[model samples]
Target: MKIVKRILKIVIALIGLLLLTGIITLWLDSSGTNYLKINKNESQFGNSYLIKNVNIIPMNQDTVLVDKMVYIKEGIIKKIADTIEVNGIQIFNGEDKYLTPGLIDMHVHVWDRYELGLYLSNGVTAVRNLWGMPMHLRIKEDAMADNIFSPAFFTTGPKLTGSEFVGDDNLNLSNPSEAKEKVILYKDRGYDFIKTYYGLDKEIFDAVIEQAKISEIDIVAHPSQKVAFSYHLNPQIKSIEHAEEIVQQPLQFDLDVIKLQPIIDSISQSKHTRYSTTITVFNNIYQMMMDDSILDSESLEFMNPLILKVDSENQFNRWFNAKQEDSTTVSRIKKQHDFHITIVKKLHEAGVTIVCGTDAGIGVTLPGFSIHKELAFYKEAGLSNYEILKTATINASQTHSMMSQLGTVEEGKIANLLLVDENPLVTLSTLKNPICVFVKGRKLNRETLDSFNEKAKNRKNLMASTLRYLENLAIGK
Candidate 1:
């Protein structure tokens, strides 16, 4: 018995040593320049070049071909088309490549640390996170401070949902006063906006909107019967997400249409608020409910084969199967899809402010890949290529209030841009193959971004394995 006890003690000590070592390693890695943060001053990795003579796809204005050299000095576009005398400026021949503003994915769940690098690899220079955890807020701060090499971030920290909203962990404000208090708290916390999830009651929603408006914070609401079109177009909520939620099915016009139409017209023209229709989510959920062959047919070309590998893995399959079989109550996701497109078409016809967005990193719309899928859905909704591109590029920037700096490539705009191998005006899919991404003049090519992701992937795996080992030790297995 004494010998056995001693052996057990030794085993426990060894386990403790291993755990301590792993934790220390993880911490060191986190603090390192190559991990969560990037060393911005390091010039050994970047190109010291003038990309001259590339066709520019200025999203807001006309495409131009003024032969000019773009100079990169310390990761910023220092000059455009300037013929100043500079020595040792390596030149990248961009005679064939096309330059446009860097893509902004307005909606993403980059809560997972690796997700940001993945987005960067896909040429997404900025992301407007609808829901952000505390960790996400920290990472955003780091990125903004230039400590982290990540896309520019804007967020509504966590989310405001009602108790009835399913399968989400968000701030549930039950009463009108509670809603008001929470909105004030969020505004004080420096959130870019208030992201409303499903199930907010009329009273609570109204209080939130009133409080948010007072706080000078915008509200991005998910439309429903509780917070439907009439409520949205009015003073409280401004924009609706997931098109169907805004105006799906028939509603009795018991309210004055005379009063409503003018209000709607005004909202359509207003720049203060806009819609981010994450139609990709609707299509994903809709295909699962009905036919999925359409999804396979269209998405096969754009979606990364790696994503399919992940989905096919037994772990994800089991999770997906369990959710699909559970039928306590399913959303009118199909009706919502049909209704949403119809309404969006109507909005476009009426010249309403429509911005393109995809709820990427959701269940199926994997990050980096979902942007293209979203544009496809927009096209299916009858928007032309130019219109669809506008939503993803120009409209997204306008929605996030960064139109002047980041939306389009112009003389005075911040040099957040993309150089693609093909003209995106002819094919939106060309955006998926970004040759280079420039954020505030700091450029990163596919190779550099991919290297970052590779490191992150290894770290994620190592962390997972360490946790599993610790779990086994806890159970004495």
Candidate 2:
């Protein structure tokens, strides 16, 4: 009996030692700056630049303002004219290049601060993050003040869900009272909005909406199929995510215009709620369905390696395993994707507001790059380049009520602009590769942008991610 007790103590001590070692490793990993914030001071922080003879595709209108000299000072577009000689500012020879308003990605899942530079490199100057924690509020405050490497950060609190709680990151509210409490908690915590997710039922969903209204915070929903889709169309429910969600829930796999048109009409008539186009993400699912080999996309290099490693067992593995399913599923996914495009077309025709949202940082939908792919899909939906740009710029800003300061290239606005070689209004692909991007007047030219992508592909941060996950869990974020 004495020997048995001694053995148990020895075994427990070994486990404790191993745990301590693991925690130390994570702390060291989080301290390392291998991947996150690689561009901390790479670019000189300057809010002034002169672009000579550039064509401006100011998003407020479709036409390009040709051969204009634009002046930016203190991070604001100071003036624009046919020619202006600035005494002190550095001049960019933008002859024949197209300058436009920086893009806004309304729906993104930003994991690390490193991802902020990725967005800027792609001419995405502002992002509205769908998932948020306490860490995110800090990121937002930092980015908002004077972070050249980061985008203008707007984030919702950690998603609220129902008891089933499919996602680990979400706050699962077991009852209506708990749902109401969390709404206040998130608002008080300084989250920009409250996001409710799929598992939520009618009672809890209503409580959330009611509480959000009382808290004076907006509600963005990934609607619960358990509740009628129409239940989420209230004015307080600001935006509904994912076109596939609509097809699955309210449409119920029915492509019939009779059913679809009514939903579109109701949303348009109300003129309050908006839809985010995550069609690229759904199309990515179809691509994964068609080819298992696609799991090894070179572009995945830009994503956080730690996320890629875990997703290998989680999201990546699920999709890769799904390739074994028969061809019928693939065809069905293709059909659903087509319907999503159709839904967008009908909604646009009905004058319903649509914002561009790539469910980036999930599956193989790479951030920064995915927005262009989403625009390509919108092109397939018969939207013109100007109209498609609206989804990314004008509409996105309008949805967030930031049109005064953003979403257009105008004198006196913040100098968040994109300069591309070819005209974006003529060929949207030019946006895929920007010559330079100005994020709050901090310019990152192409060479510096390439460095951001390269660091992401080469670095790994497993221990850092584990530490973050633990923190997020402990904080109920």
Candidate 3:
């Protein structure tokens, strides 16, 4: 009896220790001091500035307005004209430079706050994080309050899935009531949207959608394998996540472009439907798993050390071992990836709205860098440079329902703009580096942005790394 009592005490003590550790970790992760907080000074925040003699790609059209001056005051674009004589305004000589709306990555998995600077440095001014945790709410609040030098942030609640869940960030619903209850909980918690995963059943999916409508929130979904694809194509879903979801449908192969006309038409006609093409992410994984030389070239400097460790132990290990045992499986994945690219082209041609999204922070898709690669994939899929840019700018803002305030550089819009050395419409490569980025009217030059990137690359300490590794393990990542 005494032995059993002692064991029970030990178990209770261990549980208490774990609970305390988790609370401390969450506090640290959400603290403003741990992130690159933008000092809210008069010069950087809520200040008036003018960029003189610049070319503007407003992103509302395919044309550029040349030799114009843009005036920003109090985090808003106050005016744009050929010339503006404004007193007490800092002036930037934008001679031969081009200004465009900041890029947005519509789908990302944000694991840590450090990646926020990485995203901003890559010209991504806004992001829609697909997975949400308690820490994310704090991050969102900080971003919205302009306390952090981060992107315009939005996030969905934890992913809703059925059985076969792989991580702790998912709510596994076995019935309609559970789904409805979870939706209400997340809505009350202030999550922006509801993210549905692949294992959900038709009944549970319908319940989630209905509950979300009642809660006045949006639904972002990956078509469930258990449900028919047509079910997910309803106008209720805000965005369809991956291209594979559409490509995996049973369609007769034909050379005629009209073969996919019906599917495309349905998607185009839907009131609340946008597609996020995460092609670069899948392609990155395929290259790393199939080609040894390619894997060696892919750098891990910018990736979170904890993510890398978890991936190396789980996803990477599985792929590498499988490739060594059977090359045929990897070949099949490559073929599937090519098919996904083809489908993306067809969707673009059919006038379906495409939003740029890189499934970054998962495997090898580094946070900020993957969006640029996604744009390149869109180009390879036969989209013009202008069209590809739209997926990241205008279309992305539209997806997030922030078109009025974002997606374009005009008077009365938020001052999330990027100034590049060359014309991005003519050459997409110019967007890979920005001369300066203005977030909410605060200017960060290339040198300052580079410092942010460098800090993230070398920010991992031994204690944090170990804690993160253990956290990922506990969550089954």
Candidate 4:
């Protein structure tokens, strides 16, 4: 009896040790070390889908499906068919909602801490931040690892620029050599791409492009003063920010710039290069500063309140509509905008892929809701509704090289999807009514995204308001 008691005590102690070890291991794994999140064994709601009932929209033209049920497990679509023969699997009735890939906004900014909440709220599962703060990147890293709730973030880490006014918070590179070094540093630091801001000289831009290509990084450029529009023809530069051809006024200097159209077409044709046109930026800027009446428009509902709350405080105010007083300047800006639209039309005609991007979280471009505005602008610029939708959905996935895992709702794809109350096919603006969003099969409704936003916004607004008050205090009335 004594021996048996001693053995029992030893066994109990060993079991306790094992249990403690397991808990510690799980805690570390869940401590925000990675971006991949998994939500398992949840009941599916919606149409009782069978394999044959799942509709697959392969962004690629080669494969397609219709009316098939898809089986999802471990955060990925396991199979599709008229019927899946798995037992104890939850079925999500996907009949009411067409399963397409989660929308991608290739060009966006998330400087505000609460920006991620807005992105998720809009059913944007993946975003490529052209420029981002280091702190945002860290938070993104944590969010990816399930440490916090956020979108899948990929960014340039910092802007390589010479302008101090680019933003109060930006990594400034004064020279080409510095720019090259910065690109490598960011690449080493796990940045997804290289972003060049305005003011870098041609030499710096070229150097940055060369180094970026060599480092296996995609180079995205904003309209820089020092570089001519012709630079985009270079194969090394992969994508151009804001419509590449529109921002620059037509210059008559003795250079081959007239050939810009052909070069642009060639780059657009290149499988290696992609274009992200943030037309919403142009529309908003023109409306806010040029027309002034856009501020009072009902469309501004899509704008983030936080951005409107802080615009006066951020000094990089590049908001201005060109005054027609100088006929030449106004004509030039108008001509340029027209030229950009023409180029997009030409590019589309030539089969060059275009990615829909909204430069949200910067200046007048609002978060969460700006994407719909971008589509509207795309339509205004000559693209049909189908083309614009493809730009935001399927084409965007291809631009980011995420065709397999993203950009479509199909078997063997991540179950990141959006369910809208209305059909977005008829009206692009209806994409805003997101009933539910799924990131890695973890379904979040409008309420979830809104809840996250409320929590994040309260803290964020407090800080912003405090800063504003301090700035006024510093001015001493």
Better of 1 and 3 by TM-score: 3
Q: Model 1: what TM-score?
A: 0.75
How high is each candidate's TM-score? 0.75, 0.90, 0.89, 0.74
Per-residue CA lDDT of model 2 for 158-217, tens digit only, reads: 998888976788888899999998889888888998998878888888899889889888
Clashes of each: 4, 0, 0, 18
Q: Tell me the lDDT of candidate 1.
A: 0.65
Query: Model 4: which ten-residue window has the lowest total lDDT?
Result: 32-41
Question: What is the TM-score (0 to 1) of candidate 3?
Answer: 0.89
lDDT of 4 by residue, 12-96 (tens): 9999997686556434433422222333333442222233344555454433455666776766777767667877555556555
Question: Compared with the true structure, what per-residue lDDT tens digits does model 3 show for residues 1-477?
Answer: 999999999999999998897668656655623547777664655447888999999998999999999999888999999989999778989876999999999999887777898999899999999887765787799889888888988888888898676556566788999899989988888789889987998888889988988887888887787887667776668899887666565342332345556776777777567899799878876867865543234356677766776663466677778888997868867877787788788788778899999998887788998899999989889999999999999888887554458889989999999999899999899888999989998988899888878877744543454555455446421
Candidate 4 lDDT at 290 equals: 55
In angstroms, the error of model 3 at 419 is: 0.3
Lowest lDDT block of 10, candidate 1? 248-257
Looking at candidate 3, the ten consecutive residues that score lowest on lDDT are 249-258
Displacement of residue 79 (Cα, Å) in model 3 is 1.1
